[model samples]
Target: MVKKCFFFFSFLFSLTFGQRVIFGDDMSNLPGSWTLGGTPGNYWTQKSNRWFSHSHSVKCTPYDNYNNSVDVWMMRSVNISGYNLGVLTFWVWQKTEGNDFCQCQYSTDGGTNWVTLWQRAGDYSSWQAITLTNLPNNANRIRFRFYSDGSGNDEGVYIDDVILYGVNRTTTRIFLENGNYFPEGWTLGGNYNWTKVTYRYKSSPNSVKCSPINGYGYYNNQDNWIDRYFSLTNYDYGLLQFWIYYDTQNPQDSLLIQYRSGGNWFTFATFSGYANWTNYSYNIPNTADGLRFRFISDGTTTYDGVYLDDITFDGVSTPWIDLTTLSIDSPPGLVEFNDTVSVSATVANFSPYVIGTPVYYRIGNFYNALRIVDPVQPYTTVSVNFPDWIVTQPPGTYLKRCSTAYYRDSIPNNNSLTGTVTVVGNFDVGTIQIISPTGTIDSGQTVNPSAKVKNFGEGTVDFNVKLTIGSYSNTQPVSQLAPNEERVINFDPWTAQSRGNITVKCSTQLTNDINPGNDKMEGSVFVRVLDVGTIAIISPTGTIDSGIIIPKAKVKNFGNTNVDFNAKFTIGSYSDVQPVTQLAPNEERIVNFSPWVGSRGNYTAQCSTELSGDMNSGNDKASGGFSVRVRDCGIVSFVIPYDNMPVGEYNPRVRFTNFGTEIANFTARIRIGDYVGNATINNL
Candidate 1:
């Protein structure tokens, strides 16, 4: 960190000194005051990295070889005979190794009489402030030399902010804040918060911190501001200066400065990511007597926001033309269909010495360039309104930006502003719903279907509404429905003759409707015939005997109505019957045919449903041949060691148990993958 230079005030008038000459080089170009000598490796050249200001800084490269050191000097000649208590002040940054050194020397009798003022040896990685005291007031035509002897693997040195002043010069300080207390005349902003904090990169013990906390529930485009109001009416020429450290860049976070003059605000400067604590000075116009300064963040909060310190408003005596402000004005929002709107902007001159030239203003796709006349003085703001401005966009929302351009605008941040507008149409309609009947209905039965339509857009609508299902269709005319209003329309009663699933569709047809995607809807329905019943024997339907056995049959109502019937089974002289009650539509049930006692012989067996009014009786009765035989009623079997066997193939042992009253003769089958084999086992 570079130390601040302060003047020591004394009670004696002759001992008081003030700043006379201040020169700061951002290395945007070569310095005019100093003469360069020795080898040039951009050693004393401009660069973008490790700078104390914006964009570029001066870099001095050290010699790499340890055999012999290389020498270089940047010298400036000045006359100090008129003023006493002369002081030399500047900033230095260096990284040096052993035996590498730099010295500050002054020569009174040209280069032949050189005298050493200060020297440094070894390594230094940070920027240091150098102030030479007790300079000889009588020395005239003296040259100051910055000599460097570089050796070994060292990174070199950097020099900036050189000032030479005496006790005779006068200066006025309008404002100063060194982080020890809150600033006066400045107000904290809304939306985002700014606080005083101490960071390792800060210039002093503390600096002002502003961070746009924009994650989680927070959104972007936050308009946070910090403002200060003061009167700059006394003098015509001055400057507004401050030091800042920025942490990030555009599309992420941004820091902007803007000030108000003559009741209209204008942007001064905008900065993006990764910058050191650098100083900036802007010329103040005489017409900016009542000025309001503001700082804003665009809400892309990342890393750290911005640190601001050492804000000063100084009164200077120089002549330079400066274009201060540019802003958009009077743009239309919520325009009706095909309606026109006017666009306008404002521009201001903040310099008293130079008159303005041609300035350009652009709104959306339109642009205009106007020339500034001689009568316009400093602090005077002029509004340029485009005469043929119109809104030609279709009905929707659009974001438009307004911008201004002038070659003399030293600060370009406040030159543009963005906003959104909406357009609307006259007639629109929507189909809210299409609904089918909630409960079951029989085929060939008349049922009422319904649909709903609404005017969810602007104005009332008179349109055709249609409802259709398969071959049945109906259409109706809606007289008038206001916005956000809905009405239910019913179709003529139609019979669903087909079986299975079907779809009913409802739609609206309006020629001028702006949004047609929401004009149609669909719903599902199921249909079948009434009073149709079906019954079938599912198991043991062939070669059955009349004995103590549990037989099964299925009875179903395949229609839309309830059914009540009796299931009967018969084998020659043996027979049994069971009643089935209230089997609803599309339902199936099983019936057991058991406890049949008969003699051994060939016979015919039948299974059927007995219903008085049964429809489709072709599946109601089923018949098959049966032969009475002596056989086992039931048997159980198992294979030993069901799991965890060796990989090789093996036929495991088998065991059988007769769970019935008689001995059983059966054939067993074993299968794996696609292989199969059978073996017969009797008398189990």
Candidate 2:
């Protein structure tokens, strides 16, 4: 059995102490291994009688006048770059009045430049150990100093047991805050007057409070900035985390995160809305060795401002892996029962260095596969496939998860992912869908209905398929349908005898089919009447000359049935009839008729057909009219021949009649006695 593996990566912090301390002093003498500075007489001195824990401690005091300010300093030298993590620990008792405080700072350029690390005010009753964090992880020629700002009347300050030690870096946590004091090395600007107050904190005791001082509503346009810079050159990757409490009601009040780039501040993110000690983390760019970060608050005049605590800048060395994506490799469609499934995921390395780790995969109760990623480069992803998993669980859905383990992952939330996979058990099931025989079918016609049968279950099957059309139903047998396969089944011909809407259904009757809801399907189709009627005369439809006795009328059938009718045509008082025998639908015939003779005038020719049951009478009759003009036929009567005309040129007198139609001029060839000649008779 192959073991399914999963890995989870998280940042683990381990502090290893150095066997030999670089420098240690009990401060028995007046600055034995230390240098002193500031206002001449008010410098650091060893007080053997007034000390805590040890025999003697160093002390510093301010003048009784509150007008002057001074920082009497005591210094020691050590190289902080020699170890992965360097800590400066000491015991101190401070008794300062008002706003005056004792501070610890470090110098890199032999006391030329200084960076404050911690500050303490008021008083400390007993010896308290102070650990200054967020110091430069890699800095040579570094010197630590303790100083006091001399203002107001106070009992001065004392320090004992100063120790500097280096440790092997596992995971370093550089906290910018020490107990209830405000963080040092941070600069405040604009209308922001922030102070570390012990009133309200997520962890209790202390949190930095920021507010507007110019009377609430009037400070609506006030903007504040808090900035801190660090030298995190020792670590390759960095993450900045902090907690904040704010009101989400005020939309305008916001905290904007900014970073310094090319001497100018660029905003990286903006946070607004209500939260209670919500932890937020941001990735620090690799190019940011000397990175400086600032948080700006704009608005919040009427409402309360923000309280911040637990500011930390954590760093990771290299080669971190995070599982970004997870999935179950199934077929193109839905998963079926007993099918082979493979789990796969994509893992990403967000670190600057290459990583090699073990990746694990598991689905439900079964462990699927284990793989070792050889070399996952920085900011890239590697896809891993697990071993083949036969879905043995009962038919349902199960969650599948994959993960990878790495030494350091700043974001552990993205180290694993869970997805769902459905398993269909080994059984025969089908989904029947009626897709055809759902439109207007001609009456008394046979139509073949079609349906799609899909294997929606896990195994090959042989089932009985049934089709129903209206009141008629039939069953057919189908054999060997593979899983997830579809086939179209055509039923035997179904005859539609009449006009109405009817139902078409298809179903599969299998003994092993588990899902009965998808085994049957239904649809609707329409059947139309076959008999329709339309008759019209296509010819002899326009104006024409009227003397056409035997005019032709063409009759056509525009229906779906064969029709037999009597075709009748009439023009003026003349009418004729013809019998049309068994004219098929969409067929035409020429009907000729003779009209009675009439006087010259305009007459209408009407043509129609009389069927037994005509569907449309509007197309049964068609009529047209024409102007009638009679032709002239010349007639001559009562001819008087000239007696005894002997071949002489003489005019023959005759009575002529224009009997046909119009007034006419007649030319006659006369033969009286012996005269045979052509003559033009003028209008008679």
Candidate 3:
């Protein structure tokens, strides 16, 4: 009876070293906090069976002359974290039963079972080393369990040389022991959240980090930022741009891009918090060749320090790049039926992506259903027939947008490109066209405006060609516009009456842009009515599952005289809006925001129209966000030898577990740091 005593180290070795070695040889001795082996004749002891060796050569392999029934084997302890992995291998030979084979197993619950790795047979002794590639990168004790399978015979059975290799994965972590500091004018973000701030891979090039930054909750303290002046030397620059992330919960927080200018630092660009590490890029100009960079936290109390990583910057930064806008666009200040409106987008050679077909553009919604560059003209601007998609759509705001991510492998840009789009809401107003004034209308002159409005949206219902007269006011419903058809609206000299100045608005039903930032449009006009223009959102701005509702807006005239107006809004499918009226020259009102629940994507609402007395105009929309990804914890699926795996003092146990998603490869035994016997993780 083998009475075995075992002890295990529950804590990890706090060895602040460069790399860790995992050669799971079953050598049980004091002072060795690693090596957790159990059961004799297990995979670990197989290393002494004339097959194991320090080197990976079959020439005079030590295990080749083994007189025992065991072949070569080895393993080590590995703590599985997020997507961990390693590669290993072992010696091969024919068993006493003339079978040539072995297997590797892993145990997550304190090590007790023996599972199968990979099995090799038929002249196993002649083979140098049997390799197991995709080893699961997780926490568990891996062991090599060899089996004769009736193929291990001494007659021609020969064995030798075990070898193993592994891939070392790097993670973003604060050593706590090693930290850097910043001076005055500059500040450290997150206080201690470690979630904010930024991290640099290998600095100097001032390139955005390519690797994704690590974070768990809503804040970040790992403010890995670059200096204000890195001095972009002509030497080969490797890192270009860094990957950064900030919680959008704080409105003041932005991608505060900074540059060394005018002998001081200033902002270059400020992207909002609602941005991701996706199709975003930033680089320094060759003219400012000797400058540095750092993420600036917008000094907002309730904010997270930015996080950044994976930077790639070099000579004359590639002219080609990925161009992804906020996915929204606005051209016709206010879209009115019979009015021809054109949304213009400007592209430059600063990015290599524009190098392709004379700066062409791909148009489509978020559904991966894209329509490649169909330019109305050529070169710079990409035009879309707005009224066209609307009237054609069912009954929702059909936002249209376009972007470009370079090919992943190609020098300019090459790799997989991913994007998102949405065909939101249920209202569909067909094609939209705004007719610009052929002759310019002066400050308070009468203007006849018309737009060819279509149900470019998805819904079916009464489509009206609306016209607003002021800066921010709802439109007046005019009675002449058909789906997929055109109509014109004539206004009385000097439009509707409203206070302040007035603008023209002609919105169909909905306005859906691939990007949400720029989604509203209004026509050109000016007027001075006695009171503020009549305006109302009539619908909520934002929608979701778990959260507060977005607000609504409305404006009316307290004082009166004639006034021209324009207005646009984002609402639900209800299509009902309360009009704004009453008041003298000095009165104001705030619209109550009433949010609603619905599916994911964009939505809008509007109650716009045109009136003859000096028109008033209004435009407002709502936007917010939610996450679509959820991280998962790995599992310990299978093991062997049933609980209490019996073993000799120097024997090793073989264990195996599944990684769940992808297959892991290995050539050595995996184990916990505590073991009384030897162990080995070999080919199954």
Candidate 4:
């Protein structure tokens, strides 16, 4: 119900004056000018359960729940004096706790100081429509407070359908002629049983039937109604067309369309299941004075119940000039190929008067003409450039419209406005990766190789970048390259005389290159010569708790020259030898052996690298495995019962370990055929 952080004001006077619903309420009952203040018994009530439109709603600690140190208040007192600006809609449903609030105050005298205008505090699970906008034209009292403190309490606020709008400028018209049935001032309350039906009419032999027929009184829990009254004092803007036909019992038997303003009654609209003569319009609140047509029913089901007719009520002034085409702000959604781009468009004058249009601007099949010449008031918004665009169009997506010719314009479906652009590909150079001869390279090594060239289109480019391999090609020369520029190139040093996996490509020789699929790039390198490997055995891995055991290896020198090796460090049956001295070429060393005295067994730890012109002798050996426990624990792998038995009821699992040096306690057992299970193990 309350979770504040609001700010979205947008009310250009609802687009220059013309909205009217002077004051409203739909709480259905309790409305003797509404008063109920401050926590009397936790005031404010009228709840017909919970409603946003018809049944009822206006609760704030209605029956129970909301207590703790409540602070209720519901006030009302609106005259809107002469309306300078006003708009305060409503429909809320809140439940509070935490900072517990609900406030929506106003009041400029009359009820003493107040001024909040919207506050919230917690869960707002659903209905939320609050509109309030720049009010205070001498604030005429409005309220809703519901604060709490002593701790927690919920289900607090739920005010629905309240409204209040002002601002009028006179303009009137009204008609009802259905062969003049009850059309004098029109009135017929609750069970008057509306009649005058010639089978049904939208504008002919007469229509207006809610009952007096067969189907409508079947379930008979009806609450019929029909009203008319309309003075609209000085009018602001209104429109209330009609033409209805129905077959009730849809959403629990319906039909409700109210509007009374200032003295309450709000229900905007609602209908039932089947419709036919359908035509409905609404928006009449220039301080509305009346117009209702209820038709409820709910004891059971019933159909074919309503059928209103051509009732018109327009009083809207007529001065519209909406020409919107809001966006296509210039040359930027990506262009390049021939690139010229300047094109702009952002039109918008959501009508109320002042226009003077001539904005065409297209792009794709090209077309341009912009002449707004000032004068575009109302809600104003301009920015029309259109003229540069040159993008020869080749690589994809294009559209981009933007029209507005304003003549008798009153919203010609929003004039025009399309958008999309993306051309790309003027010269596009490529190859953006492959830096240096990757991975292992040794056979007489010389290596320089580099790559990474970019410049993807739009001018400036002087490329050359090539760097094959295996047949050893070179070429480097990239000179200008601007436009997303990259550039790394470096070739010229090739020597690795052929040995094994080679590939390595790298291209980009621009000269009319129009997207050759990103030029080229491939990679791989591995030449070799005298090698010397071993690579890893550093310290007896995994499990060991016995005694002195120094045995390491890791030798490297995949040679190109400078080499000297010996490595070797067995285990299990014990063996040792180390000597790796001048290891230079690709160099890496760590070979120490000579101290071995172990116990409790589970060993296999080889490590070799003899090297005497090795020449890739299968990477010169390396193995591993260790275990010299002083007290071990077991089970290492077997999750849940495994051999496809599919019978059910099972919880046995396993994956245990404790290759130990002390601290061990255990008990684990599992069997299938005879079904046996046990598990208990700790400290190891």
lDDT of model 3 at position 115 = 39
lDDT of each: 0.58, 0.61, 0.36, 0.72
Runs of candidate 2 exceeding 4 Å displacement: 1-169, 173-175, 178-183, 191-207, 211-219, 231-236, 243-249, 258-304, 318-548, 555-588, 593-597, 602-654, 662-684
In order of TM-score, best first, we have: 2, 4, 1, 3
Q: In model 2, state the lDDT of residue 125.
A: 57
Error of 4 at 192 (Å): 15
How far does residue 479 in candidate 4 sit from its true spot (Å)?
A: 21
Better of 1 and 4 by lDDT: 4
Q: Estimate each model's TM-score.
A: 0.26, 0.41, 0.18, 0.28
* 452-478: candidate 1 lDDT, tens digit per residue: 888877655567888888777899888
Residue pairs in collision within model 4: 1-123, 1-124, 2-121, 2-122, 20-285, 21-285, 663-684
Query: What TM-score does prediction 4 earn?
Result: 0.28
Stretch of 10 with least lDDT, candidate 1: 3-12
- Give the C-alpha lDDT of model 3: 0.36
Residue-wise lDDT of candidate 2 within 336-383, one digit each (tens)?
656676556777776555545555566665443455565677678888
